[model samples]
Target chain A: MFKPELVNTIVDAHQGPDGLLTILHAIQEEFGFISEDAMRQIALRLNITRAEVYGVVSFYHDYRTQPVGRHVLKLCRAEACQSMGGDTNAAALLARLGVDWGGTTADGRLTVEPVYCLGLCACAPSAMLDGALHARLDAAGLENLAQEAL
Target chain B: MRIYIPCDAAAIATGADKIAAAITAEATRRGVNAHIIRNGSRGMFWLEPLVEIVTPQGRTGFGPMTVADVPGLFEAPATHPKAVGLVEEIPFFAKQQRLTFARCGVIDPLDLDDYTAHGGFAGLAHAIKLGPAGICAEVKESGLRGRGGAGFPTGIKWETVRTAPADQKYIVCNADEGDSGTFADRMMMEGDPFSLVEGMTIAGIATGATKGYVYIRSEYPHAIQTLNTVIARARQAKLLGADIMGSGYSFDMEVFVGAGAYVCGEETALLDSLEGKRGQVRAKPPIPALVGLFGKPTVINNAISLFTIPVILEKGAKHYADFGMGRSRGTMPVQIAGNVKHGGLFEVAFGITLGEIINDIAGGTATGRPVRAVQAGGPLGAYFPPHMFDTPYDYEAFTKRDGLIGHGGLVVYDDKVDMAKMARFAMEFCAHESCGKCTPCRIGSTRGMEVMDKIIAGQEPEKNIALVKDLCETMKFGSLCALGGFTPYPVLSAMTHFPEDFSKAAIKLAAE
Candidate 1:
């Protein structure tokens, strides 16, 4: 729920902050993701429509309109990662988790999202579980890491 | 005082942590006044584990260090020390025209005062006085182009978005620098997170948008951490909140980590991924200006493009614009990668020939072999032979010679490189990275790969060669985005310049 005062504050807040990315991030943090109420509040506050607010939320990959899991499992899919079998490792992990990217596990313990490079070129096939790095991973290594999460 | 050590993945791969640990243990053993702070790298990668002592002058350097060398540092072991000598006089640091990269490796990345002391907020301070239109005009006059490959005029893009009527506007910085043999963006973000923040803020002011996003590749974990730490500090300082500098200008940014997709480096594709889509390229009639990031006016600039804006605004336009030759105005941060000695970041002005950079600055191949083809930009960039080594490094000149000045990444190959294999790699890269947006790119890339396979196999080699050419031509004209369009440059350039390599396959096939 977004308060009228918060809406006015957020709208007043929107003028100089680029568009609404920071507001959306804040809102997402507060409510787990961008809510219809938050969008409407932003629209009313900024003198725009709900569609406008929703549009901003949906445009950038950073903004989440839906709730993610407790821990985010981000797999590296950049070129160097691919050269080290990132695709195969990702597929094997996905099969074990039984969910596609942006999909959280049934127990809500983990969410798998595909990520680009983690900048570990020399040590390839890397992944980030939550915010920590795991490098030079084979499929078995990733599954072992995934089991720890389970 | 805490001695900063970079264990960022790049530095770790090069053994930064072990040296840092060794230094700490050595310092404790000697009961000296030193503690190690595992900081992000300064981006001068050639100097890994580049230890800096807090001298009264500044942070001093001694580098490419190992754990064995750490204990020796206390007793003065650097064959070439940074602090003892004029730190600024080092040829690597001295030769660079670091506008965007000005503060990198010079200060504590998390300290706001450290940033300000090193001339960090001067641009933001100056920009606040001039207003949005004034900032845009200054950038326009500077003739600063996008440094993240395309080299389009940054000022013009800012002006268009500044003037464009919008209910909402956005500034999206593309930090997805997937091009191989390039590390400037990563190095900058890790070394000088504040500069990028300052640069993005300047863009936000110029574009009249209240929000910004940095779509950094997930590969840059150290950069991400440094940025996150810096953003928190900036928010606390009221520099990035509701009213920046009490100027009624509000611009805040959040970093969005990208899933692996080289195609996402393209502006439209980046926009799509930002919107939580599949990172696919879109047709540009709506051209991110009129309709971008949620179908609103958006200023999508590369990391280096945004990074250059603060300096352009702080210093006058003419002062900034007076750096380079015609049309290719301002400095280019050339990234020297792959099989070259003295390989690292070399930010120089335009009009410098390939030979001067590669042969003189880089000192030729690392393998002690005569250099053959030099690939500028990245894998998608054209490979030039020894004859074209004198070509000037600029957008117009590169285009004139049927090549590109993409992202300033120059990957050198020795005489041992098979140009034919290199050509096949271009096709293979396109096939793998294509977003499957258009037939010519998606379908044609696979065909191109198959055709290259046939030639490599010597199966109807002549027919395969013609097919590859035809496919490249079709992909050039017919692809929806640059993924297919520019793939031909590497393919055809190899075909024309390295005729003997491709022809040998046919001759070998005839003999069979």
Candidate 2:
């Protein structure tokens, strides 16, 4: 549900090959997701095919087409995290929350997603809630973090 | 009094921002005249939210701080329960040979004067006098290699870009630190943004590249924000942009954010992403040095590689060449992470052995269990058993052991770790992040996963292990980029080092 004025505003701020990434980032920043309407409009303005826009949106993990919940919790599920019981901790957190990977809570307050890494491997089992990274996470810490988001 | 609190993402994640705010509020209410400096992390991650008070003895450290610790901090800073003594004197920090990261935790990242006061722009200022070939020769003599895992000589890469005839050349810094255990790039960007700026500026002068681009990953929002802020500040101060330092040579840089593709860390793929395309690998022969970033001659380097330039220029090539073992010269900002007791950044000369890093610098496993293995480099690096701990950290040394010093990310694993699952995770990671441009990587990684699943399931174990080995070999030589080529390192290393874990009777699979 991107407005025509927002599309015009985004397009006006950038130029050339760099414009696509800049525009996509601007739209994502303004709204949580890049909707089909937004993608179509981007293709129209940038003079590219709609298929190309969708290809980009689907290719990158960060470019989500659907709207996420109020708070996003990205748990690092990479090797470093795995070395420190991140998998077990994540499974327990998910079980307690009663949601699967990429699922939002029934209250619409929180969404849980799996990220490869947050670059906080030193303090393994790292997580990012609303883009703020948390380190040395445990089951209790995860619960507290979830509660804070609520 | 001046108090320093890290505003880096890791610190903010652990409530450093809240602690900073609480300290400000409490200090004002208590009539304490204190100036707060939001600096970068000292790379000692565990003690983060690490508060430091400027004292006669230097910055006294206190941390793993919280909002609740603020009032107590003001009451008795030195004797507080969290106080860990001077930041510099801490055994973890005192031993580091931090050439590139020297100013990270020491200065306000955005303050140009502070940066300059602590030897900022000295490299750029030095490069301005050397001209192009002279600067390239200096870098060649420094014996620096790419810190982005490839270990290519930095001087040769610059010389190729310098000698190449092009109307418009470009300098590209690969800040896509997608490896699981790596954060050195993030630390450098967040802690000392100006060093990168200065280093990149030096590249522009050396290679005759008037424009530069830093392709940072989307995961590092804090790093992106810091780099952007400092870039603008440097421009205003004329350390960047038109006629820098009145040298009549012009250079400018912009930060380009990548949407989350592991392959983008590869130079060619990064160049493609910068051009607003899906991040995919490009074949090389006419390497990125001769033709990169919009088809002009480009000097592509990792964040650490470029960040090392300023110090090289400032201190002279011989000074930097003096450190480290043969061939693999200079200090590596080794990121010791995973299930380790002293997990943090330890920048040291390249000759140190793995045993010293794990047992000495990192202090072994955080779980207090005996360390079973360690994965040096990134996801693509081979896992090393305790028996191989004597291997040095030099690039050639690691290569000799069928390992790599990729990005110098060392992830320690305790005895509790299941090698079967670790191997599977490697394949799963490759499958998830593969660009699908190449057949062996795209298909072989998936096939490898299935084979690993069967081996862990105790289904035709001998046959499955052989099949997995075959798949790995195919992916090793048949794939397009490092993503496909290096995935074998982890899988094969796991199989070789911990064969019992993959035995038919072991049957250890990760809980799905």
Candidate 3:
């Protein structure tokens, strides 16, 4: 399932001083997560060491080493959301799902992670399910989102 | 019939897309000639999916609509339960001055014709005549400060970049809007993206930089998508490529999506990230203006700062300078959010008091409770107690109180909030997002969080609070960037303003 040729193509497509971030994004876009083999191929193609590649990848919170579930739900844990009972709602969702932060559901249908902010403070307690944003989430609304994801 | 619907992410989050689809189907079923335009948000988020229809009077508004309300759009709109009269006359919208966001929620984001028709490129056209020095002087005269966090003058920054000798200079727009209660940059990017493009282009012309990059966060996928589309369209229209608008000025930009690092919002860290490295903070000896972006001169500005440039150029520096109080000239698109009624973006001149904004304009807390405190600026900004509500929304005014108006974001909290927990979270956030280049921020944040936890657990409250103060002092001065330096604001502010919350009895009360 891991394609080495695709990594080469991705690295070649983004060839410059500022191509690493773009290349990593593309690889993740294609493979869901960056594999070790993919990392090796990226280092070789970009004339950097595997450690350097790993450093860059590991430094950013967005880059993932392992695959996510069918759907990824990023819940806001910042001050704005926290003010509007985000902590309580988030705790309720986590308890119901039997998972913690960055945990995947038992059925592997959904993964819940904490994001700082999605810039939707006006409608506090926001979340992004597979890139589409949802706002003003109550405990029921969060549960509904979990159900939808599952 | 013309219908206006917001394509802003906030609007979309509240089911704007579904509302649009329902309206489309209903119009088709009714055989009414319907032309739907997906415009940007007007910043009145409470009335999101705020639909508007062209009337002889003006664009009459209706909103917070649902799919169920679609059929009624075809009927007599006058009797529609959601109708809120003319869009421009709405009190929330009418009260403030809208300079940078004038075209937002008004024009189709990607339509070049619509953008120019709303006086879009007139600023760039004037900038071409002003030449480099004139442009820089105008910006300096306008007294426009960095809308990012630092209140540094935009003109001085441009002048430094312009004078710096470089074979290949660059313009970087810092769109990494990681602040919690801020969405002005995101709204502008999603709504009036061309203004940003035009602004950056003007910067390039002023500073002799041909290439630019908008470093956007991955969280803002809609902003990235909108900017990419607008960039492509601008290139096709010959507004971005070489010899833009026959002005013989060559400037083009691309959107670079940031992987999710909050510290990347820092300029040096952002430059390093742009260069494909771990977003560690570089020292400020050389600074970004003279030596930046692969050792070349770079003019890195916040998206709002750059977006505001066009208006200053078009209307002249004095016009913008005359608006604000003291050194803080021009208007700020102050983002009012979190637990507050009438939460939205209010772009106004810089002299309004915090009490006026929180009480009168925002109509107080959404929970109908008494206002406890407001964290002006972002997470890094200090928390202001109700007693300090008279503090004006100016840079110096905030700084006088040992606070900052960073990014012009105010996250209001009701009386139900526990200050101790909020303080601990700030330390936790810093630890989570720290770039790990320095020792104080790297280790102090974790230690700070642990100490706060111990205090919360009723284990030696006085000593732990004192220790937190000491650690905050170290972090405030020792850390490399604001990420470490400013973490103390929230921690100390909470400890200073709400001393009762940090007590052992209060912890027991909270637990009970």
Q: How does residue A89 of candidate 3 score in lDDT?
A: 96
Whole-model lDDT, model 1? 0.77
RMSD of each: 7.3, 2.0, 1.2
Scored by lDDT, model 2 comes in at: 0.90
Q: Which runs in model 2 stand beyond 4 Å of their true positions?
A: B504-512
Q: What is the TM-score of each candidate against the true structure?
A: 0.79, 0.97, 0.99
lDDT of 1 by residue, B425-499 (tens): 788888878888799999998888888878877778777889999998999999988889999988999988998
Error of 3 at B86 (Å): 0.9
The true-structure Cα RMSD of candidate 1 reads 7.3
Give a tens-digit lDDT track for model 3, residues B1-512. 99999999999999999999998989888898899999999999889879999999999999889888888878989999999999999988999899999999999999999999999999999999999999999999999999999999999999999998889999999999999999999999999999999999999999999999999999999999999999999999999989988989899999999999999999999999999999999998899999999999999999999999999999999999999898889899999999999999999999999999999999999899999999988999999999999998899999999899999899999999999999999999999999999989999999999999988887888888999999999999999999999999989999999998889454686588
Lowest lDDT 10-residue stretch of candidate 2 chain B: B503-512
Binned by DockQ into CAPRI classes (incorrect, acceptable, medium, high), candidate 1 is incorrect
DockQ of each: 0.09, 0.78, 0.92
All models: lDDT? 0.77, 0.90, 0.94
lDDT of 3 at B196: 97
What's the residue-level lDDT of B1 in candidate 2? 80
Better of 2 and 3 by TM-score: 3
Those runs of model 3 whose alpha carbons end farther than 4 Å from true positions after fitting are: B504-512
